[model samples]
Target chain A: MSTATIALLGQPNSGKSTLFNALTGLKQHVGNWPGKTVEKKEGSFARNGVTYDVADLPGSYSMSANSDEEVITRDFITSGKADVVCILADSSQLERSLFMLADYAGIDAPCFLVLNMEDVAKDQGKTVDVALLEKKLGIPVMMFSATDTKAYDQFYFTLERALKEKSHINVSELEKEYEKIIGYNEIKEQIKGGNISGYTPMWLTVKYLENDKVVSAKLKESLPADAASKIESIGLDANGAIATGECKFKWIDELLEGAVNKTKTGVKLGKLDRIYTHRFWGKPAVVLTVILGLLGSFIPALPIMAVASIFDVLKNVIGDALVSVGCPAFVTGLVCDVVIQSFSYIVKMLGFVFGVTLVFGMLEEVGVMARISYVFDNTMGKLGLQGKSVMPFLVSFGCTMGGAAGARVIDNWGQKVLTIALAWAVPCGAAWAIIPMLSTVFFGAGAPLIIVVLLLVMILHMWITAKIFGRTLVKTEDRCGMIMELPPYHKPKWGALFRYVFGRTKDTFFRVVKVVLIVCLIFYILSYGSGVNDTSILYKVGTAIEPVTKIFGLPWQLFIAFVASSVGKEGAVGVISALYAGGSYGEGFMAAMSGAARAANLNELLLANVSRPEALAFIFAITFNLPCVVALAATYQEIHSVKWTAKIAIYYTVGALILACLAYHVGLMIW
Target chain B: MKKLLELLKDGNSRTPEELARELETTRDDVLRQMDFLEHAGVIRKVPFMNESNGCSTCASCSGCEGGCAAECKGCVPQNAKMNMGTMWEVV
Candidate 1:
């Protein structure tokens, strides 16, 4: 029997093993390659009275020295042990899988191409013309299904033809592609007639352009000293690899253009994606979606808001019962005013938290949030920040502390600080809850308009703040654009979405309840006094600051609430509940209230004491205030610069007060 | 591929589909080019906080190194959304 050795080469999962096993079966022996852990398998089988010895080489992504397997595989191919080489390409995804064939084009060894997984290709509705690919490649090419035993006959026939014909890949077309790359001709000319074995000069030049360390080192060692110096003087460009890679891809595309047919060739965006990706309309479309989403959140929150009001009614009824039962005033106030009232506000905030988390979380689940982020990415650059700054801004809407932490991804220190600086301007979840509640209390049915205006002001505020900070923080640099692989829109898993929403709501409820209760109890105790006395510590302190606070259109009581907001925005609601309801601060204003209104709820009491303009100013102040002390610590933690952190904190504090002053003046003109 | 890089230099973010349309090629082809460019160190994937996947320990360093401080869950949240799209940019 006559024996011919054949080596199998392919990327992992290209059916190299299946083909090896089908041909060799029980005749195979496996062992480790010398000085490496990569597996080596060799076997022999007799077909049609001829014996074939097969060596299954270690699979690698390409013939590069990135890994030991690649080096071992390439070395074995050129070691001259195999008379013929079998190169496998996955027919199902020829665009990607043919990379091995492309890389192997310039090798001097005789080889044949096996378009494996022909069955899989057919199932995917792909029709590949084997004869056309063979003619283009100038080698024996066969459609193959390695998993089918019956296909061995054709595989043997092709192997026999390859060994008999000693066919090598047609490199003329490939070399033409390489010639388009700058410096290719110079490198090729210098390496021509050089002593580097097992590779053509064109192959060595292409690998050198790709910065292939193995190839470059070999050429440098083998070439004459003068010739090596001349090649080095040409100087490799940084983009050489990118250029050569592009050329190889173009060559592959050309080779497959007429050889493969498929129904879908390119990515197609869905309808919503088209609108969200539109150059002129994308920003507007994303903004409108957010507005609608926020509005939609309110619908689900209304039921929870209604449930929270029951706690308010229960507070009044139980307060009357405690008074009738001879309970101490402090005890009654602690139970009804501090505990129940705080719980009521917390529950109401939880309503909005649930709504916001659910709506936004759903958007994320369905992939619209990614488009929103992409839309805002370029806008980040206009602010002298990278596209990634949008993430911190988005996280800020949920929690400013979280936003500050998210800015850690920004490697540039200036941009990191600036990103956190702007993130503070986004009103957090607690502010979101209080703003709409207060707006509803003051503006009634016009709450949505207030939300819209606040959203608009947020944009204006960020733009202005970016201008003020961008000069000092971020320097001018070439801002590279980003490529986003937008996730395809899909139906949200309602179970997971609701679970997350409820989890977030429960977390917010517990956290807010604790802060609100403690803050409310402290303020309520401080404000405890006889009717209209103003002798209580809170009243005395508030009155002392009323003049300064008045400039911002905040009453002493509202100013105290604003200050407490710097602790935690939920504390603002606590201070408001305690000062407005548990004390006699509203006594003088109550005289102007109708007899029926006197017996009205805490919202009515607040409306009686706080004018619309003052309410607007206070709302603006707390919304824009330095988010919370926790956020302050978080900013310091992230930036690790005390001066910058303090700078950002002071900036937000001063900016919030200024915003409040402007809103107050604006409110004075409007109302 | 050079055209793709040039398009990114305009400082506008584009999805792969949009890039494919502008490049007048299939998205798979664009992706292949991106893969090569990225491997060649000409571009990189933009890292995000959620990419941490709630791993409080830094894989790239030892002993915190000012990342994922013990008191802060900000860098990695247990429940951060995982469905955000991928983004890449030139290095």
Candidate 2:
């Protein structure tokens, strides 16, 4: 049988392997290239009483020696081991897939182009004229799907013609494009055509200018010292790759100008994208969307909020039954105040958690969150940070620890520290849970209005904080540009979206329960026993700090809860449940003495004990406070500077108090 | 492609659509050029939230163990910014 060797070459996903498999069937052996990890495939097939040997070259983007696969592919084709090369391009996206053909222009190998995936191109409303492309390329070309078992006849026919004619790509047009590059002619003049066995002198010159290390070193070794020094002195421009790449792309576009027809689906932004990406309107539009989404969350939360009342009923039933059995007041207090009250608060907080997660998760699912990131990316640049800094800020919305961790993408230390500092201004998941829950408790139907105001204040807080820390933490010159690919909007996968929401909420429930129960039980025992309200260290310490805390409009109990929030936002809730329900042991004492009615629930207790203005101040306090001790550790872990981490922590704490003070005054005016 | 690089040198951020508009070219053309620039090392992909999965070790060189497809339970909540999509930066 007459045998001929052919190599299949293409970019990744260009259907090279599929064609290789179809051509060779089971007669294939896969092994690594000698001393290289890149896979080497060799096989043979007999057709029409003639044997054809197929070598599948490693798939790569181009002929440049960027990776082992690329080096091997280039070396094999130039080594003249293949009688003909079967170059493949995906017909569906020839604009991109043809890059391999463009880069392969100068190799002295006879080849034919196989426009694979013709079926997919037809599906996308694209049509390629095989005759026209063959004329333009001056090489055999066929358009057929690699998966089509019946299409091999055309492939084999084209291969035979390419072998018989010894056809090579028409490089006159491509060489004219390359000649336009600076120093192309000068470099070509120095390198002889026959010096490199497979690479043409024009190709060597282009690769040398593009700073291909292999090509440069090879030319240096072969050229006389004086000539080599002249070329070396020309130097590698940072834009060398860009300029050479532009030439190849321009040539590809010109070659395919009339050879390929595609439906005109122009890249135009949708109406929503227009507003969401507008230069001035983008920020306001994103801000408004987030506020509206937060308000929408309350709708889902209302049901879960209503469910929390059952805990109050359970608390009364359990408390009264324990009392009827002559159980001690301590046991009743532990069961009613600590266990039931903390769970009631946990359940309420979880409602907001579920609601907020669902709304935000749905936004992310439908691809609107990417727009939010795009909008804020510009803002990040204005803050003397890289666009990527916005990523950490976005993550902070979920958890400050995660945000601090996300800051690792920012390579600059100063910028990273500043990013973490500013990320602290964004409310974390726990703050979202607790803020809306408390807002509804204090403001009722006006909770949405409060959420809107908090979002506005958050924006203001981030700006002012950036101004304060930016000068020292980030340099103006340390900024760089970014390009983003906004994902197309699609229908939300409700199953996945809801699954994530429920999973997050469930996690929050378990995590919050542990923190709240522990914090609640500790504070409860500290305030238990006869007149311990007067004698307990917590009460004395809380009362002693009341004067200092009152400056922020926080009562002693709320102020203590504000302190507890530094450990965790849920700990603040635990403190509130314990302090309000236990109440200087007032409920039990009053029940024993004057038969005064016990507070109906924690809501009634909070309403009786804390004024609206004080409640508002406390909300602002915990909302902006240092997210948690875990976040602090994470910040330290990232920044690796105790000084900066401590500095950020102190700044956030002081800033939170200042915001609280301002919010209290505003609340007093509204009330 | 040259003009695309020049536009990015202004230290501003742009989405692919905006770049396509500014360059007076189709998004596919712009994307093709980006692919070339990326492979040629003229630019680099910005490893963002979706790739890193917002995990703590992601910001470090160690990378996520399973590279974002695997769940990194508890370190970062699942599905955080999973749809933020890809980003690139000029080298």
Candidate 3:
């Protein structure tokens, strides 16, 4: 059997994942490695009649163990399992990649040097002598693209021959280097760990030198106290030893010196990149983007209003058809109020979602978002964040799903989590989707005032929450730093925007729609089935929640709606719609809010609770509450902790309660 | 601590053992509180540790041109002090 259990390792954007996917196809998943939550992926394919188990370790610059991911990569390399490691490098960014490869080379393990993205290197008009590099490094070198199958096939043949004969590589010329490495395998596991686990080697050593308590604790559990203390004493303060390893990035320099010779010169963004990365500019740039993004948000919100109005017309036409069909009164009411209301709400939610997606998609599809990142690099620094990493924070406002999805762009763990948690505080489109509905329904006369107040409260709440959270959740020393490559501005591609929006929206819609529909249907059945005087479930539930609702000037039934809102905020809106269609929102709010107008056969607007100022509080509260079950699942999945997910729920619940209460009063004051 | 930091920042070179001796502590003790020093890139290891064991109690050939540069290969004494280079600073 050909030993093709190739493990790809390198720094970020070295095209490792791309090559892995290309070699094994997209049929894979990010699973755990042994026991840790760090993403582990495995894919298998048979080549030359041998089963090949390919592992795609997390991308990292060195195995020095600064981060958990680095540790994992280091461990995998040091772990005897990998038959042949295909260390991929971006030929353009060889210095850093090769620096990491140096430690691997220090071990002289079986490896294949794959220089990926050859096309990009060529496009840049650079020539690398593959044979010369292979000769110099004393290892097999393969130049190919994961995007191109033809290149992979040629590379595959070379890999096949090398795998059949391990240690065929002769490093006799580098006699001293080889001798230093030959018997050093015994010391591999002696390296402890850092902020994460004990598995990754490079990070462990760095963390050890840095004297990171977390890393040291793990190491102390395994090694002697005297030894640990001695190691801790030698390096610069603590992390100095780790930093030294990275500082001595001579291997990276050598790799660049060996493989790359630039043919053309473009205006590199050295000054521009640095200018934006300044501390003063970082915060202000972020402020401007937020203001501009918010202001422009209205421009993009137009199509949603049109689409929502279209749904309104469609519902009206359906209502007219129902009247013509001479359906029973209850049947007509149920169809119009319950089903129609939910469908229209869905359309409204989709409209706003698609609209926002259109704006962001256009910005990202053409790769100009990096310009926006550049403009605020300095501002990001002032905020103690890596500039241009604000998308994850902003997207959480639209939906935490988007927030989590967008966080994939950020590489730093500390920054990614903080950005995610902070953005979850932002009010989503679903929250604002409550506005038009409220404006049309209850406060038919002063609808505009109520809508304005609700919108104001959402913004104010986000600002306050952001202020408090940004100050607290982030650590004191994590002074934001920006080191981003500003991509060149390009013409916005319409088709790409459409595809980006559709792909995201479709995935999101499918994930959330079923829960919403089921909640809506369940609420409809409960309110209608139980609300016959004192016998109906609605009447019973209202009575049960009456005291609790009274504290917030709401009826008892709203408690049930509030509980379901945790599943998805729209579910709360859906339940309200169901209640109104069941002749309960108007009846129940009056029953709950102390003599609310008693009206029979309410308009679609009235049945939807679209206009009540307090409905604004309820909507926004639900918006900010424990994220929908999907989000809860996501939070649990991403963080890999059920307890943390529950803690997040507790946090949001308290935040929602306080914010909603304040919103209810402030909306009253403003309106 | 302040003087050494300033000197390092100003690009002064001092061996870890000398600094430890000056501080009147073990080499490990001086190295233990090296937080800001490391962050600021003040203290570093000599490039190669090949002769580190040999010179721990003997004459340091690192600073002299007599060995690689000092042109004196093996006549250095065991009790002589060490001379370090930044290359061996954990790299």
Specify the highest-TM-score model's number.
2
Give the least accurate 10-residue stretch of model 2 chain A, judged by summed lDDT: A590-599
Q: Candidate 2 local accuracy as lDDT?
A: 0.85
User: How much is A577 displaced in model 2, in angstroms?
Assistant: 0.8
Question: How much RMSD separates candidate 2 from the native structure?
Answer: 2.4
Model 3 lDDT tens row, B10-85? 2222334445545564443334334223433443322112233333212213343344423212122122211211
Residues A426-524 of candidate 3 have per-residue lDDT tens digits of: 555455444444444455445445544544554465456445555644543454222222344456666655665566556446644665567767776
- Which ranges of candidate 3 are over 4 A from the true structure? A1-304, A307-326, A366-420, A427-474, A478-482, A508-513, A529-535, A543-547, A550-560, A585-604, A607-612, A637-644, B1-91
TM-score per candidate, chains pooled: 0.86, 0.96, 0.50
Model 2 per-residue lDDT tens digits across residues B1-91: 8888889887788887788889998888888988988998877987765464444453332455666555432234545447777888877
> Which clashing pairs does model 2 show?
none
Candidate 1 structure quality by residue, lDDT tens digits, A1-671: 78899999998899999999988989999999999999989998998788989999998877767788989998888778889999998999887778788888887789999999999999988999889988998999999999988998898899999999999899888899898877889888989958666777888898888888888888889898888898899888777776777777778888998899887745566789878878899999999999999898888988988998998789777877776788776687678778887788777777888888789888988999999998888889889888888888887887888788788778789989889999999988888878887887788778778788888889898989889988998974746788888887888889878876776777677778888888888888788765454778778888898999999999998999999999999899999988887754655533422122234677777887799889999989998899999889878888899998888888888888888899999999998
Better of 1 and 2 by lDDT: 2
Name the best candidate (by lDDT): 2
Task: For each candidate in turn, give its C-alpha RMSD to the true structure in angstroms.
Answer: 4.6, 2.4, 18.9
Ranked candidates, highest DockQ first: 2, 1, 3
Each candidate: how many clashes?
Answer: 0, 0, 51
lDDT of 2 by residue, A322-344 (tens): 87788777778889889998888
